[model samples]
Target: MKYIAPPRDAVDPQVFSRMPLAAWRDHAGLIEGRDWPSIEALNAHLPAAARECFVAQTRELLADGLHYERRIAERGEIATRERNWHDLFNALVWLRHPALKRALNARQAAEVARMGPKTRSRAQCALTHFDEAGVIVVASDPALIAPWDAHDWHRLFWRERTAWQDGRAQLEVFGHALLEHALTPGKLLVGKALVFHSTQAMEVVLAHAAAAIAHGELLCDPLELRPLPLSGLPGWHPHSDDEAFHRHAACYQPRRTGRSYPPAVRLGHLGRAALV
Candidate 1:
């Protein structure tokens, strides 16, 4: 089913309390009591580190004739549509993860320059996928990735559910679209993840992911990303706690024939498989 965002006035403030939107609740809280924020208001929320690449109203960028990514790369301006949930969530992601957002913008702008704004490369597709639905999954145990790679939702999400709460595995939502989708009640959210093996703090892993992306060492191909059914994550959905849910949920997709994922990105000084 296609996701159609509700009007700003129609969105329920309670949706932000959901697990999938947990990472964004702090930013989303800013708008719960007021009308949708204007582009200028969105810019005001940007942290000092992100002040250089500020949010610009979409209309203003349309007249500039620069490609969206290129504008951010060259002029440090992110084109954002006011009152739109998608763009609003995007701005929030920018506020929370400036380095990662900047890295994605840099890579995208580089692709635009190389492939021409009229065309797109495989790398661009992967970059866009991550930007829209990406999750940074850090795992302390390499064994945890087996079920995920095999698309075994039952084993990965149910059998190993404890990993989610014990800090053995953690998911940081990077895709604004996922946050946007959570606005709909009972919507099933899935994330494209770049799993890494490490024991480093989430912030350190995120920094590594950003650096890797900016340096063109990651997201070179769409196949490199792994699918993760977000609903299966503990506390993400009401039914997920039941073993039957993992077995019968619509989101549980079987592994495709001949499909195999590449190894997780292994960071230096690893105590276990980690994330970025």
Candidate 2:
């Protein structure tokens, strides 16, 4: 099924006042209170070091043989559509996480160079998945991640629910497509998560994550990511407050046979350590 965006005028601006989007409220407010922003408006939001520009996607631009990733890496142009929720969210991501975005672009451009535009490797697939629907799951306490590795939804979401609010655990939404999907009222969003057990601040964790990506130390394979049901986080979904919701919701899938996840990235006073 094709995704049809809600009409710009018809979409309630209040829809962004929840988790994930709420985290980005400042950026969203820039475009939400007025008419859809033009490419120039989007470009103005870019940081001084952001070489990439959000250019209008046109037939003329598409006619160029360069692939999308190549266009950004080689020409520093990001093809963006006018009035597109997905593209708008992408610009917001660029504004919020420029370093991470740049790292992802660099890795993607490298992969495109290695495997031509005709084929994608496991690394490219992992990169694309994260680019579309990724989340950074940061846990101050390593113990908070055990249930997630075990796929114990009830234990993770219900028993340890307080961890989410207390800052011991956090879900930093990093994918524009995931943000676009949030436009649908009451959607149960899931994120492809890269887990980190860190004692440092989020800024530090983000830096390490970006460096790891650019250095080819992370996001090398799809299996390295964990499936995170975003709605299971308290207040993100209406049904999540009830314990039974974790047990029976369609969003809560059991762990598959032969499925195993790599250890979460570890960040401590010594800086980034090996996965544990």
Candidate 3:
């Protein structure tokens, strides 16, 4: 998909006035995108402060501190399932494939057996245990998922790193709206490519049922990021207004001259007028 560049004056004053902490953190990628420079060009265009903010924000997002949690949940869950399947398949391959079986010794076969079934319960237990206390936990910060320990990359040597990559790609896409509308202020540029690629991930998943299922499972996992309803803000047209806005607005006042006022207001006005 073609990339859509945000306008030069992308910052909407009105939106900024209403901005919440969540919006700032959630759209940091978009802000980073606005000033992102290639590694080679990094020394020239991007300032140290901006770069610092970008790295910090991206790291925060990837670590599940930012809005990237949804992406992490969606991508992480699916990737976990896929990895489990791959592990099971590898075990089966070792056992059933003629070439693999010949290469494995009796001890190796026993070890594979110990690995056991790939059913939901076993996989869930394994993942939960590892996630809770595993030395190598996959963190979902903004657009990257690197091991907490840089020197121990070999631990995951047998694992599929592509799953995390794919998950990040998916997340970058899911956050496009936030980036476009909330992140960049004066001019948009830096992380735009990331957003574009991220969006493409979404498109690819929608086009394929298997991909959709994986993404959906990731989205539905309760332990992961939960999707929040966007109904509280203005223009959302909430489904119900049981607690009327007028009750909460400090400046709200009923018009005395109009019959449109509620019964209480009308009676109060009538009593006041009669007393005067």
List the pairs of residues colliding in candidate 1. Answer: 196-274, 197-273, 197-274, 198-273, 198-274
lDDT of each: 0.82, 0.85, 0.26
Q: Which stretches of candidate 1 lie over 4 Å from their true place?
A: 49-60, 269-276
Q: In candidate 2, list every pair of residues with a backbone clash.
A: none
**How would you encode candidate 1's per-residue C-alpha lDDT over 61-167 as one tens digit per residue?**
58889998988888887777767778878888888888898888888998999999899999999999999999999998899988888888888888899999899
Candidate 2, 188-258: lDDT as tens digits: 88899999887667877888888888778888999999999998999888788888888888878888998
Q: 175, model 3: CA deviation in Å?
A: 3.8
Model 3 residue 155 CA deviation (Å) reads 50
- Residue 143 Cα positional deviation in candidate 2, in Å, after optimal superposition: 1.9
10 residues in a row with least lDDT, candidate 2 = 267-276
Where's the lowest-lDDT run of ten residues in candidate 3? 259-268
lDDT of 3 by residue, 81-197 (tens): 111212222222222222212212222223234553232333333223222211111222322223211211222121323434445323221222332333233222111111111
RMSD of 3: 26.3
Clashes of each: 5, 0, 14
lDDT of 2: 0.85
